[model samples]
Target: MKKILVLGAGYVAQPLVNYLLKNTQFELVVADVHLEQAERVSGNRARTQAVSLDIRENEKLEQLIEQTDLAISLLPYTLHLQIAKACIKFRTPLITASYVTPEIRKLDTEAKEAGIVILKEMGLDPGIDHMSAMQVIDKIKADGGKISSFKSYCGGLAAPEANTNPWRYKFSWSPKGVLLAAQNGAKFFDKNQIVDVENDRMWEQTWPLQVDKFNLEAYPNRDSLPYISRYKLEGIETLVRCTLRFPGWVKTMAALREIGFFDSESQKSAEKLSRDKLLRQLLHIPNGTGLRQIFKERAGQFWTEEIEERFDWLGLFENTPENRHNENTSAIDFLVSLMIEKMSFAKNERDMVVLHHDFIYEKAGIRHNWLSSLIEYGRPDGTSAMARTVAYPAAIAARFILEGTINLSGVQIPVLPQIYNPVLQELTNQGIHFSDINKKI
Candidate 1:
């Protein structure tokens, strides 16, 4: 059996751990800073250990890589370089959820030389969204049509009923990372002309979107135009990449931005606090067992008084003299955290992964429109939508790699037809399929 090692244990990590343990033929080993979390998720079915990945020690990393056939990093995007180096050193295949940063892209040449595979963007957006959208884009192109533009969007959200907080969000995953990402407001892109939305300008933009049965809102999360070359779209003129959000979320986010939630111009105060105190101040949100009791007159269950109180005591949301009214994390981070709590899948209520794709193409001198999307709501705690959506693609990709169905190596992605078509086809066979809707020109 193939030996697989997974790093980091978070909302995304749990699903990956559970899936590998129960389904695949691989012997799983999970390493986290927190040993209890690793054990809690893996039980005795898989190997669970505790290790600090904070400071990179090349030899130790190589040993782990030497031990496992594959290493799936559920860690931060920033940690990719170290992980990538370790993978290359041990000639082990690798995968991660981070966007392929330029530094990472540079490793492509080295990874290829090493004859090892490194797969990035294997999570939800970069994971399922990329492959799913490409599948449709390629299919439409083959039908003999001139593509006008492409806009793709995806979001991890909480169930509707659970959205009852001031921010309508929660901390399903890493709150600090979420807090840090918002400062990446603008990017340089080559869509038509040079496009730039820097600093606070990022919060100023909003786009409207609709995919079959759902109404949605979106905002550009990162660079979009570069994908034209990556996706091999030669003549595509207009394209935009966006992040999805519930209604009214944008305005509230904008207000938070206007108030300095997006500001990372200063962090001296934050640097002065002890780690525990700093985290406490940063996560000090008001929370309670009973929204009616703790919040009583506060907001909703999205974050009851007890929850806020914990956050306050813990230093997440509430304002306190101890907090010192300083910005410990980014507003977008806080917002994403807030959304996680609000949107997380529950024991009974199901969680869904929705990927909406809209394509416009011209054929026979006629312009036409086609809107396609895939909606996969997860089973529950035992089998979540997040897990299924995330795990399916990786599991499918791994099988293809192991079975020799997919043969190219190097720093790779899900842009190829062989990878997506069969993989998506398999997902469809398992009740994960995208729908196509066509309208007159």
Candidate 2:
């Protein structure tokens, strides 16, 4: 029997593992640094086993790679290169949900030569977003329309009923990952000119966006210029990619940025301090001064009672020893810890994922506007919408590669028809499809 090796059994791994076990005949091994985490997902099922794996152990990783027909690295993006090297050495196919990096892209030639596919960006924003966008782009071009403008935005948040916090959001995935994304500089085309936004100014660039009846705000996501050629939108005007969040998030993030929550050097300086002291150090508040007044002065226009309440509720002002952990933890680390502890969903509460795309094209001298959107809600059974949207597409892609349905090799994403068409169809079958509308302008 063929074998499959899965690395990193985290929040999203269970859905992917369950999908594979139910749909395929492959023997499976779910490995993690924590054997219990791997075992929790593997469930002692037939042809499935759980094992401990510290990815740093190259020999064991290679041995497992050599034995499996394919390997899926659900490990953190930083660790994927090591796993990829092992897979390439053993001529084993590898898949990941993380975005493709330059180092990984450079391996295309080597991966192709090894006769194995190294698929990246197979998760939510990078995965479903690519597949869904390409489907529409391909169809519009096939119909002889020229795309003049395209914008896409995606977000994961607490479902309406579950949004009880002052921040109106909760962690469905990595809190640190979400915070790190805010530090990214972005570049995108607007009206035929490149608009560059530095990391510090990202939140300042947001504008309110209406997706169906849900009012939200959007700020540019990472670099979008490279995707013009990738999406065959060369010479296109007004192309942008954005990250969505509920209203008030942008202003709050801007305040956080101004207050030094995202500064590593400053965070290091504030290390070993209690939460309130850390906040004081970051804000330069004098001892015995009022936090509200000092914070409001520092936050300036971003200051609001609701934002203050959010920070207080997060325990940022707490002086208790309970708020301190790992004396060496930095301010950012403390904030992430607080978010993970205080912002996690309650029992029976669910999260939501939103993806929206808008397009403008011209065909036969007539202009048209196209809109495509997807809104997914998590199950009461504890399966998060983030997990489903992020893992399901990757699981499907893995099956296709193993079944020889996706014949091409080398570094790849899921933009091609052979990959996107069937995957989109299956997603719809799984009740996670989009709503699209086209009309003359």
Per-prediction TM-score: 0.78, 0.95
Clash list (residue pairs), candidate 2? none
* Candidate 2 C-alpha error for residue 310, in Å: 2.0
- Per-residue CA lDDT of model 1 for 1-441, tens digit only, reads 777777876556666666565545667777767767666656666444445444266676677789987888877788889889888878888878778888988898889888888888876678777887787777778988777777777775655655454444444445555545555564433355546787456546666676555566777767776787887776776677777766555554443444344444333253444434433333332333432233222323233344444344433434323332455464345445544554344566555566776667887888878777777775644566666777667766665666568776688888888777777787787688878886757
Error of 1 at 284 (Å): 18
- CA-lDDT, candidates in order: 0.65, 0.87
Q: Kindly give the stretch of ten consecutive residues in candidate 1 with the minimal lDDT sum.
A: 290-299
Where in model 1 is the C-alpha error above 4 Å? 22-24, 46-55, 186-194, 262-350, 382-384
Query: Each model's number of backbone clashes?
Result: 38, 0
lDDT of 2: 0.87
lDDT of 2 by residue, 126-206 (tens): 899999999999999999999999999999988999999999989876588888887788999999999999976776689
lDDT accuracy of residue 261 in candidate 2: 74
Poorest stretch of ten by lDDT in candidate 2 = 263-272
